[model samples]
Target: MSNIRHHPKTETLAAFAAGRLDEARAVVIATHAAICTECAQAIEEFETVGGAFLEDAEPVALRDDALENVLRRADPGVNVVTPQKPAGDLPETRLPLSAYLEGSIDDVAWRAVAPGLSQSVLKAEGYRPGVLRLLKIAPGVRMPRHSHKGEELTVILRGAYKDEIGDFAVGDLADLDAGDTHTPEAIGDEPCICLIAAAAPLRFKTVLGRIVQPFIGL
Candidate 1:
C-alpha cells in the first residue's frame, strides 16, 4: 500500500498519458507520478493501452522534415536537464519540475502574497487561461475558501496541510475540478510548500479572498 492519500482522477491520468494535457498541468501530474507508485503504475497501463491503439492504426506518410524535427527535439542539449540537490529544508524536487528551477527550491525568488504566505509564478510557453506557481504557507496559515473555474492540480513538496477534502502530505496530489471547494491550512511545524497548476481563475467565496484574488492572481 502507498502512503499517498490523494491522486489524480483516472480521466486526468488518461489525459496525461495521452499527451493531451497542457504543460502547466502535465508537470504537476509528472511530479506526482515520480513519487507515487500507484499513479505511476496506472499511467504505465494507460501508455500500454495507447501503444496498442497506435499499433492497430493505419500508417500515414510523414513530412520530410519530421525526422529532423524529432531528432532536434530529442537532443539532450535541447530537452534534458540534470537534477541538482535541494538546499536547506526544501524537499527533493522530481525531474519534471527540476528542469524549471535555476538552483535549489530555497533559491527561488518568492513574492509575498499575504501574511505568512509567499508565491513564485512559473511561465509555461503556449499555455493559456491558466497559471503554474509555487505556494509556500506557514504553519497554521489557512488558505482562502475557493472553488475552481476549470481544473486545479496541486502536489505537496514539503510538510502537510488539511482541508475539507482531507489531509495532504508530501507526494500527495489534490486533483480538483469546478465542483470541488475547500480551504486548506498548513498543519505541521514546517512550512507547507506545494506546486500548483490551475487551468482557470479560482472562484473565491469570501469577500477578503475576492479582494485579494486580483492582487495575488491565484
Candidate 2:
C-alpha cells in the first residue's frame, strides 16, 4: 500500500496528458505520477480520452510539398539528433527526473541554505526564473515560514513533512499557489528529500529569511 496523501489537480493531470504543461511543471507532475499509482492510472485514462479525441477529429490538408520538404529536412546532410539517456544511479523512483539529477541522490552536492536545511538547484532548459530544486531538511527541523510568489509544486522523494495543510509522506505532492502559505517541518528520523518546482521567488515572512533569500537564490 502507498502512503500518498496529496496529488496534482485533475486539470493539471489533464494538461500533462495533453502535453500542455510547461516543462518544469510537467516534470514535477510526471515524477509524482511515477510514485502514485492512483494518479498514474488517472493520467493513463486522460491520455486514452485524448487519443480518442484526436482520432475523431477531422484531418486538415497540408501544403502541397509538405512531404517533400519533410524528406529533404531528414536528409543525411541534416543533423540527426538522438535522445540522450538519463545519467544517474538513483533508485528508479519511477520518475522522469534522472536526466536532471545526473547522479544518485547521495551524489548530489547540497549547499546549506540555513540550519538543518540544504538545497540543490536543478536546471531545465526552457524554464528560466522558475525555481526547480532538491531540498533536504533534517529530521525535526522546521523551515522558515514563507508564502509563494506564484505556484509551487513539491514531490516528496523520501521521508515525511508536516505543514498547515497536512502531513506529506513519500510519493505525496504538495500543490501550492501564491495565495497559500505554510511552514513545513521535517518528521521522523531520516531527512526529508523533496523535488520542488516553483513558478517564482518565495516571499519569506521573517527578516533573517528575507536577508538570506537573495544569497540562497530561493
Candidate 3:
C-alpha cells in the first residue's frame, strides 16, 4: 500500500463516509480509493469507529414515503442522460500557469508563495474559503518540505511532479495530511500544474523556510 504513497486525511475519510462531500470531490476520492487499499481500509475503519458519533446526533426520522418521493424525481431510465464526453476545450498558452486552469489561469493575479514559486487561486462564481486552489510549480523547483494543517487534496492538471511519494501525472489525485511531509519538484520539460483544496494552512517544517515563514506568508 506504500506504493500509493499519497492519501487523504482521516477526517476527510470520515466526511466521505458521512456523504458530506460533493460529487466532483467525491469522485476524486473514490477514484483514489479504488487504487489504494490502505486508504480504502482506513475509510472502513472510520466508518466503524466513527459510527457512534453520527448516531448520537440523530436526524429526524424520515417519512415512510420520503425515499419513494426522492426516487420519483431522480432519473430511473439510464438513457435519459447524455453520454460522457471527453475533456478538450482548454487552450495551450505561453504563460506557464495559464495552460491548465479550468477556465482562465491567466485571469487570476499570481502570488509569490516563495522565491521560485507562485500560485493562482481560481475563484468560482460562489466558491468560499475552503473551495479550490490551482498551484503552478516552476521548473527545477520544489516546494519546502511541509505537511498540511488540514486535509489537502490535489489533482495533477498538467506535466508531472514527484516527492518521496510516486510521480503524479494528469488525472492523478493525491491526498495529504498533517502527518505527511513532502517536497515535490516539477519534472520533465514542463512546469507542473495541479488543482488543490485545503481547509487549513500549510505548515513548513524546514528550518530555513520556517525562518522566512512570516515573510513568505505561508
Tens-digit lDDT track for model 3 on 1-218? 35544566677777887777644345446655655678778888777766877778769989999999788878566437674333345532222223234435445567877776767655422233354566788777888888877666787766789888788876566777646778899887887877676656678888976876777655
List TM-scores for all candidates, in order: 0.85, 0.85, 0.57
Question: In lDDT terms, which candidate is top?
Answer: 1
Model 1 is weakest, by summed lDDT over 10 consecutive residues, at: 86-95
Worst 10 residues of 2 by lDDT: 86-95
Better of 1 and 2 by lDDT: 1
The candidate with the higher lDDT, 2 or 3, is 2
Report how far residue 172 has shifted in candidate 1, in Å.
0.4
Better of 2 and 3 by TM-score: 2
lDDT tens digits by residue: candidate 1, 56-130: 999998999999999988998867576456543444544578767766677889999889889998886444566
Cα-lDDT of candidate 3:
0.66
Candidate 1's displacement at residue 44, Å, is: 0.9
Score each candidate by Cα lDDT: 0.88, 0.85, 0.66
Residue 86, model 1, lDDT: 51
